[model samples]
Each structure stands twice: as structure tokens, then as C-alpha cells.
Target chain A: MKPSISCKFNRFDLLLSLFVVLAAAALALFFLSHAGGEAGEVSIRDGDNAPYSLTLDAPRRVQLADGHITLVIERGGVYVEYADCPTQDCVRTGKITRTGESIVCLPNRVVVTLEGAGEFDAVTG
Target chain B: MKRTLAALFLTLLLCSCGAPREPESVQFFAMDTLMTITCTEEDLDAVHHAMREIARLDALLSRTREESAVSALNRGETVEDAELAALLTRAAKLCKATGGAFDVTVAPVVSAWGFTADEYRVPTQEEITALLTHVGAGGIGSDGEVTTLAEGVSVDLGGIGKGYASDCAARVFKEENVSGALAALGGNIYAHGTKSDGSPWRVAVRDPFDGSAYVGALSLTDAFAVTSGGYERYFESGGKTYHHIIDPATGYPAESGLASVTVVCGEGLLADALSTALYVMGEAKAIEFYRTFEEPFDMILVTQDGRVVLTEGAAALWDTSVAEHSYQYETINKL
Candidate 1:
């Protein structure tokens, strides 16, 4: 007589199969939640204009305020290369590479913020 | 058995897909800093209202704007704006409470240092002494209807303006019945409620020693947190670095043996003022002030000796596991 399909598999075999499936699901969930890493986008808000974004992978220079303010994005870092604003605080911010770091120009009303998968909602200092 | 396993896998995927939606965020520049407000999508209108409220406060409180009530007051004008008068009274009370460590009348000294004008300089001892004569909270007199400044005394609300703006934003959030929100007006932050997922908002405290890293994070809900540090604004002159926070007593940059001070309170304005006062007070006096203060508050003091000191209250909500650097952590309880 032919053995039934159920008879071929013991309790241990069934349990092993379940364990493998659960492990796969857990790994998938972990990656899904922690998807973004150092590779994120730079969001730039120039004055009252709507904010525009540029991927960190791209190397480029962005000019705002009629070329008075210049922003450079390269090598996974962003910085204010030159700014005509009186304070020049933006230029003094140096290069911001980590997520949630921002370069703010108060006089120019320009805020360049790094947006990535950060663990915190806001940073206080 | 295979069918059952398949069903379980599908169920797990479904659960993951049902995670809470992201909140709507609004970012704007105001009060000389970036302000970001985030709330549930349905409460977006409340965010806009909060922005308008902050703008209104900025107009009334800005010392730079010639037309602002504060500028008028600085010019020795008797301003009749009730809101301004109320804020001045509250500021004076905090100034007196902190034993003049948080005086608003330190504007002249701050200006002499050129922090407000962004033309950084190290004023001479005589110049600072001359400016100190104009610095005192007692010089401000308000009778509920009108407010006036003593001769040569000008008040700068820069220390408390952002914090008050956060308070105004909170008021707007409550008026609109917002379920949850986060308003970050520069260093002053207000975590309105839990996230959409019912988890406390995690706010990272920037490391005083390192700009790219954080010392730790605070899991906060419905709280106001403010941080004061010399690192925020500073300039180097003659081989010495001078920060923006000035000592009321000596009319110089506060040398309180502290790298930074973070104050968490139920009230925004208090948190803002106390952070500055505590920074100026240093470690020992700050702990003493915390214990003797009437209202309940928590503090995180990062000392120059590379120590992160948390009051008992702050320790309850602090998580230093993710801190970028390993520093000595100590918790101080009320005496």
C-alpha cells in the first residue's frame, strides 16, 4: 500500500518547515522597517518657494536667491559653498553628512536639511 | 499543514502593511531659526494656525524688526500691547526666580559682544562694565496695562521668544483639538502627544562636543524641552572662544564648567529660560536650584569633564544606549 502524504511527514518535519517560514518573515520585516541608510535625500527650501529635493547619490551645485547663495552636494555630504547673506552662518555650518543635520541661512531664509531614516523625531540642542 | 503555514505568512505581511501613516510636516523660517511642525494629516489646518500664531508672536517679540513691539520698547517707548506686557511680567518673574541669572535686560551686554548683529567681537572690560549697568530685570516695570524700560535699559526677548512661540503653537494645537503634534522652534521643542502609533516622540540631544552626533535621546510625550549651550553660537578672538550666552554677574561668556544644559518642563517658557539660567549657574548651583525650585522640572547637564548628568526625572525618560560616545552617566535625585 502507498503511504499517505501526511504519513511521510513527522511532527519535527512540520515544525522545521514552520520555523523556516517564520524566520524568513522576520528578516523581511526587519529590512522593510530599516530600509533607508546613509543614502537619503537633501531637501532645500529657498525662501517662500516650495522645498525641492536632490538625491545624495548625485553630485551637483544648487544656486538660490538669484545666485547669491550656492549649495554643493558631493561625496554623500552637503554644504553651503558660498552665500552672500550677511551672517554667513550657512557657510559656517560646514558640511552636513548625517541624517537630520541641517544648514540654515537665516538672512536668506534658506534651509537645507538632510532627510533620511533617522531614529528620532526631532533633535534638540 | 503547508496551507496553514502559508496563511500565517500572509497574515504577518498584512500586519506589517497596516502600520500607521506618516504625519504631515511643515517647515518654515521664523524667529531667526528653522521651525518645523508635524501632526496627523487631518490636523494639518492646526499646523498652519500654529505657524500663523508663531508669526504673530515674532512680530510682537522680534528685537530686530524696527516695527516690533520689542524694538519699540527697546527704544524706550511705553508699549500698550497686553500680550507683550504679560510676557514681560512673566520674564521678570523668571529672572527674579533664577536670581537674575536669566535676566532679559542682558541685551546691552549681548549687543556689545555683537551676537545680535552677527558681527562677533570681544568687547573690552570697560565696555562690558558699561553695558552691565543697563542689565537687570528690576529695570523693567509693567503695570498690567503698560510696560516701560528704565533709562538706558533695553530688553531682548531672544532667549525666551522661541520658547514663547512654542507655547503659542501648543495653544493653537489644543484649540484645534489636535490628536498629536511636534513643534520644533529651533532648540525649543514641544512634543504635543504620542505618535500616531501611540509611541512617545523620541528627541535627540545634540552632543555639545560633536555637532554630527547626539549624546542621547529623550522619549517624550506632551512635554517641552529646551537646550542651551555655547556651541550654538560662538566666535574665536585672540586665542579664546566666546559664546553667545553671557554671565549676568561678570558680563562675559558664562564659564560655568558646563558644556551644555538641557531643561525639560511642562511649560515652554520656563524650559527655555531655565536652560539658559542653569547653563550660567554651572553644575552645583543648577542641582541646588532644581531641588529648591517650586515647580517640577528635569534637567540634563553635560559637563566640561565629559559627563552626562541627568536628574532623576530626566533619567526616567532618557535612553543613552544609542549615544554616539560613551560618557559617564550620573543621575541626581532630589535632596
Candidate 2:
């Protein structure tokens, strides 16, 4: 009696393997890039410009194109007290006390990032 | 032929399944602050391993924990941890070098100010004087692995634990095949390698008077920039401010005429130790220590009077253009 086993690698098998590998790579990439920030730091942007950082330790109102953004530092915390935008979403975002928290008003092109000092790639304390 | 195909498929699957992507980040709280590890890696395991190691050290070194090495000493027992022994030994050397400025046995004095307990209090002279007896690092006894402190004396590695944490993280980064990474423990920073962009890391010298503003920035790579500041952690009592860094001799907050001291060098532990030591040593003594130091290191000091002085070699690190607040920058020689 004789017994034989044969293995095959078809084009479809190769394509399927490639697809699986690509999908896994894509998923990992998505998650990796999404790992952004922590703490309470605010960065403002106007349209297509770069973000201008506003120190959370410094409490002051910022003037944007349309409405004004008020930043208040009270009791060792920073928050967006008021935004003159239409949706009021920025105000509703509440105070961000932890790392990686941010508030953005699309209408006013204002972005407030509550940057956590310790939760960064590199922090100079 | 068929075997090759199977092997290739297995390899692909195995690589895809367990491998973590590069530039992965991990953040957790340890050593009384947020410890972040951002590294170039294909697996999170290395970063996780680093975190576990650091957390273990944190537990072992914590003065507040009953099971910690220091706690063991406080209870008149000995410890047998390699890292603890090494830390205590190095701290002893630093204390001697800085004329007992960086004493681990200053724990009683530090805790007396309520910085450790979160209950701020100004200890009376009598209280401080009593605590000062056990203040110097001369009490730390180590024999290779096992170590002990003098009876009634305790140790606190807060002066250098974070720096050692950064060093441990850097080692893990290398073992994990991470090319470039940053390990930061509050004001203690270790730019393990250059940035992902292959440029030097820019670290700001925080304003000693204000947390929100920086006095200047430092360009560094493969270096640790650790700062000891009166403003880092402080409490106000009756219009007077008391900081966490205590002077062993006086049993009080150091009046070294320095608002903050930043030490930059290749070694994280040294930078951390030197920053604290130099802060307590003041400018003149620090310059002397610098001259006598075997290895090269740079220092940036913000005096209580608002003068910024850096070793001549340290100018490359400080970016005067980036400071939000104006500082009177002074360049000092190796005197």
C-alpha cells in the first residue's frame, strides 16, 4: 500500500494571504496613529494654518475670526468658559482635567487642547 | 516547494499576529508621576515589559509603602534588591561630592514639610532639629546585594528614582529594538535617541516662578535633561512657599539662591542626581563640582534673582528664541 500527500499554493490563496496581511497592517496602523495625547494643553488653529499653542497656565481670552474664545484658569484647572460660536459645542465640551482632552469649535476655527504634561512622547518638565 | 509555501504562510501569519507596530506609545502612573514610553517598536511587549519593571522599582523604592526597601530600613530591617543597593551607593557618593547636599536620609525632613503627606505644615525648629540627626547618607549600609540604613534613619529615592526610571526605560527601548524614544518622568526627561525625524529633542527650561511658561528650550538627543526646581511641587503657608527638595543639613527647604537647576548629560541618573545636588549646592559650589566632575555635563541655573546661567558647552541645548518669558541668559566658564 502507498500513501501520498501533496500541498498546493494557488493564486487565490496567495491573494487571500496578501489581503489578510494588508488588513492587519492597516488596522494596526490606524490604532497606532490614534494614540495621540494626554493632559490639559490648548492649541488654536485658524483655517489652514498651524496650531498655535495657548498655555493652560495662562488664562486669557483669544480673539478669532468670527467669535472670541475665553480660556479661564481657576483652581489649578483650565476650561473653555465661553465660545461665541453658533453650535456652543466648544462650551459644552466642558473642562478637561486629564491628559489628551481637547475642545474644538468648527464654526470659529478654534481648538483647545488640554495637554497633560506627563502623557506626552517627550515632556520637558 | 510545498514546504516552502507552508513556511512562508506561517511566517506571514506569525509576524502579523504578534507584532506591534512601530512608534507605539504606553502611559501609566508610577514613581509619583505619569511615566510615558513612546518608542519605535513592532511589539508593545517591550514597552509593557519596561512599564512592569519601572512599576516594580516604584513599589520597591517608595518611602510611603510599608513593603518598600526604605520602609524595611525604617523598620530596622535590611533589603536585598540590586537596584536599591546601586541607588543607595550612588546617592552616598553624590551626597559626599556635594558635601551632603543630596542626602537620601532627608526623608524625615521632607515629610515634615507635609510635601509627602499632602498636608502642608511648617515644622518647628525643634521638630526639624530632631529630624536632622538622621539626615545624611552616611547611614546607608550596603554589601553587594543586601543593604541597610542606620536605626531610626530612613531613605527616600525621590531625588533620583525618576532618573533611574528613565534609564531603565531606555534600556528596554533598546532590547525591544526601539530606535528612538522618549522617557519622561515629570521634570526628569530622557531623550533616548534623536526624535523620529532624526532631530535633537527640544526641551524647555520651565519658568521657576510659573508652571505655564518656559524660560527657554534645550536641544538634546541621547541625553537626559532633568530639572530640580523650587516651583516643581510647592505649598504656600502664610505667604511663604515651601518646596519638596529639603536640605539635609538645615532640615528645611534649600536656600541655595537657585530657583531651579537643570542638568543635561548622557546619563539619566547623573542628570537627576546632579540637578538636585546642584540645586542645593548653589551656583559657586555647582561650578566647583562641575570642574571636579570626571565626566562632562552641562547645567542651566535660574537663580532666585532671575539670572539664567549655563555652562559654555550648554548653549547648544538652550533655545533662547523659544522662551515665552524673557530670562537674562548668562554664560559661565568651567571655573
Top candidate when judged by DockQ against the true structure: 1
How much lDDT does each candidate structure score? 0.88, 0.73
lDDT of candidate model 1 versus the reference: 0.88
Measured against the true two-chain complex, the DockQ scores of the candidates, in the order shown, are 0.45, 0.12
> What i-RMS does every model get?
3.2, 11.1
Q: Would candidate 2 be rated incorrect, acceptable, medium or high by CAPRI criteria?
A: incorrect
Model 2 clashes, total count? 17
TM-score against native, each model: 0.91, 0.71
Native contacts, share recovered per candidate: 0.58, 0.25
